[model samples]
Target: MAEEVKLFGIWGSPFSRKVEIALKMKGVEYEYIEEELGNMSPLLLKYNPIHKKVPVLVHNGKPIAESVIIIEYIDETWKHNPILPQDPYERAVARFWAKFIDEKCLPALWNSTWSKGKDREAAIEEASQHLNTLENELKDKKFFGGEEIGLVDIVASFVGFWFGALQEVSGLELLTEEKVPKLCKWSYEFVNHSVIKENLPSRDKLVAYLSARFADASK
Candidate 1:
C-alpha cells in the first residue's frame, strides 16, 4: 500500500510553498490542508507542539515541521527527481546558499517590509547587501546550484513569488531590471516554472492579506 501523506499549510506562507514546490518537483502525492495561521487548527498544534507552525508534513502518521527540513526529508525519501546535487562539494555549496538565503536574506527582507523608520532603512540596506552578494554569486551560473534547479533554488523560490507581493504591499521595490538584472530574470524563470506558477497564491489576494497583517501589527 502507498504510504499516506498529508500537508498542513497556510496558503500565503512562503515556507509552505517551499515544501509544496519540493513535493511537486519530487512527484510526491499528498493531501493539502489549508490552515488559518491566526487561529491554527488543533491538528496542526497536535502535530507541531513546539512551534505550532504550518507546512507540517504528516507521513504515515509521523509529523515533520519546518519548511526546509520538510523539503530535505522529502528529497531523501522520494529520491526520484533529485533536488540536491550528488557531488559532495556541490552539495555543500548548495546547502550553504540555501542556509544563507533562509537565515540572512529572509530575515532582512522581512524586517524591511514589516518595520518603519530607521529600522526599516537599515533592513533595506542589509537586504540590498544580501541581494548584491547573490547577484555576484549568480554571475556565472544559470541557477544558484548551476545548470538545474536544486536545493538552493527551492530555498530561494520566495524571491520570485512572495517577495514581489511583499514589495507591493510595503511600497518598496527591491528586485528591478536595472538594479539586479540577472536576479530579476532568474525570478521570472523560477516563478514561471509550471509547478510554481500553478501553486502560487494570487498577487492581489496576497497584497490584501499582507496589508491587513501590517495594519493589525501596527495596532
Candidate 2:
C-alpha cells in the first residue's frame, strides 16, 4: 500500500504554499485540508501541538511542522524529483540562502508592509538591503541553486507571490524591474512555473484580506 499523505494548509499563506509546491514537485499524492486561521482544526492542534501552524505534513500518521522543515522531510522521504541537491556543499549553500531569507528577508518584508512612519521607513531600508544582497547573489545564475529550482527557490517563492500583494496593499514599490532587474526576472520565472502559476492565491481576495488586516492593525 502507498504511504498516506495529508497536508493541512491555509489558502492565502505563502508558508502553506511552500509545502504544497514541494509535494507537487515530488509527485506525492496527498489530501489537502484547508484550515481557518481563526478556528483551527482539532487534527492540526493534535499534529502540531507546539506551533499549531498550517502546512503540516502528515505522512502515515506522523506530523511535520514548519514549512522549511516539512519541505526537507518531503524531500528526504519521497526522494523522487529531489528538491535539494545531492552534493553536500551545494546543499549547504542552498540551505544558507533559504535560512537567510526566512529569518532576515521575510521579517523585513513583513515590517515594510505592516509598519508605519519611521518604523516603516526603517523596514523598507532593511528590506531593500536584503533585496540588494539577493540581486548581487543572483548576478550569475538563473536560480539560487543554479539553473534548476531547488530548496532556496521554494523558500524564496513568496518573493514572487506574496511580496507583490503586500506591496499593493501597503502602497509600496520596493521591487521593480529597473531597481532589481535580476531578482525581478527570477520572480517572474518562478511564478510562471506550472506548479506556482496554478496554485497562487486569488488577487482580489488577498487584497481585501490584507486591507482589512492593515485597517485592523491601525485601530
Candidate 3:
C-alpha cells in the first residue's frame, strides 16, 4: 500500500482547504505540511515546479498538482467513500461543474473583489447570475452532486466557505438568500458538514486576513 501521503498547502487557501477536506472525508491519515506563501518550502517548489502552488498531494513518492486533480486522485486511490460518481455521464457532469467553478465562477468572484466602482458592480452581478444557476442546479439536493457531498461540492467549496468572508471584506453582497436562495442554503449546509466544519480555517481569522489582502490589492 502507498501509505505515505503528504500535503503541502496553506490554511487560508480555498484550493488547499478543498484537498484537505477531501482527504479528511476519505478517512485518509496524512501529514499536513503548512507552507508559507511568500517563502515557500523547497519541497513544494521541487514537487510542483511549474506552478509552485500549494495543495500538492504527494502519495508515496509521486506528486499531484492542482486542487481538482489532487481531489480526483484521492478519490481513486482511497476507494472507500467515492467522491465522484460511478456512472460515466454523472461523472462527466460533476467534472463539468467543477471546472466551471474554477474557471468561470471563481473568476467572477475575484473580479467582484478586485475591480473598482462600475467594474465591481458588474462583477457582483455576474457572480450573482452564476450563483443563480448553481442555485437552480442545487434545487432540492443537499449537495451539488446529490445527498452526499461529492466532487462538485468540493469544487464549489469556496462559495460556501470563503466567499462569505470575501463579501464582508469587500462590502459586496452577492450570496444573500434573496439573490440565490437555494445556493445560499447550500453554502451554509456545505460549510457546516461535520467533515468540512472541522477542516475549515477560523472565520474571524480568515476575514481579517482577506480584509488586509483585499485592502493591499486595491492600493
Candidate 4:
C-alpha cells in the first residue's frame, strides 16, 4: 500500500506556508486542501480539535497539528534532505531559535502592526528588540542555519516574507534596512531560494489582502 499524505492549510497564512516549504524541501508528495478560518472544515476540526486550525498534516491514518512539529516530523521521516542540524547541540540551538521566532519575534511584530496607542508603542519596542536579536544572530552567517536554509531559516520565513508585506499595509517601519541590515539581507536570500520562492503566495495578492484586512480592523 502507498503512503497517503494530505495537508489542510490556508493559502495566505505564514504558518501554513512554513509547512508547505518544509514538505517541498524534503521532496514529499502530498495533497493540499485549503481552509478558511471563518468556515473551517469538519475534517480539519477532527484532525486538530484543540486548535481548530489549518496546516494539519495527515499521514496515512494519523494527523499532526502545529507547523513546527509537522516540519520536524517531515525532516525525521524522510531522511533525504535534513532541515534540522545533524549534531545534537546544533539541533538544540536550531529548535531554540525556532521557538524564539514563533513565541517571541512573531507575536511582538504582529502586535506592533495591529495594536494602537501606548500598546502599539510598547509592541514596536518589543518587536524591535527581538528583530535586533535576530540581526545579531545573523550577523556573519549567510543564513540563520548557516550557509544553508535550515530550521531557523524556515521558521523565520514570515519575518522574511509576510511581515514585510504586512509592514507595507500597516505602515509600521520596524524591519528596515538601516535598523536590521543583516535580517534584511537574510530576507532577500530566504524568499529568493528556489524552493521557497516557488512555494510562496503572490506578494501582490498578500499585500492586497493585508491592506483590506487592516482597513477593516481599523474601522
- Cα lDDT, all candidates: 0.87, 0.89, 0.91, 0.94
Model 3 lDDT, full chain set? 0.91
Global CA lDDT computed for model 2: 0.89
Candidate 2 TM-score to native: 0.96
> Which model scores highest in TM-score?
4
- In model 2, the Cα lDDT at residue 199 comes to 75
TM-score of each model, in listed order: 0.95, 0.96, 0.96, 0.99
Candidate 3: misplaced stretches above 4 Å? Answer: none
Candidate 4 C-alpha error for residue 84, in Å: 0.4
Per-residue lDDT of model 4, residues 152-177, tens digit only: 99999989999999899998898999
Give the range where candidate 3 is weakest over 10 consecutive residues by summed lDDT: 171-180
lDDT-sorted candidate list, best first: 4, 3, 2, 1
Across residues 1-219, which tens digit of lDDT does each residue of candidate 2 receive? 779999999999999999999988888889999999988999899999898788898999988899999999999988788899999998898889999999999999999988889999999999999999999988878888688789998899877778988898878889889889999999988888888777788878988999999889989
lDDT of 3 by residue, 137-172 (tens): 887998997889999999998999888998899888
- State the number of backbone clashes in model 1: 0
RMSD (Å) of each candidate, 1 decimal: 1.4, 1.2, 1.2, 0.7
In TM-score terms, candidate 4 sits at 0.99
Q: Model 4: how far is 91 from its true place, Å?
A: 0.5
Q: Which stretches of candidate 2 lie over 4 Å from their true place?
A: none
Inter-residue clash pairs, candidate 4:
none
Quote the positional error of residue 19 for candidate 2 in Å.
0.4
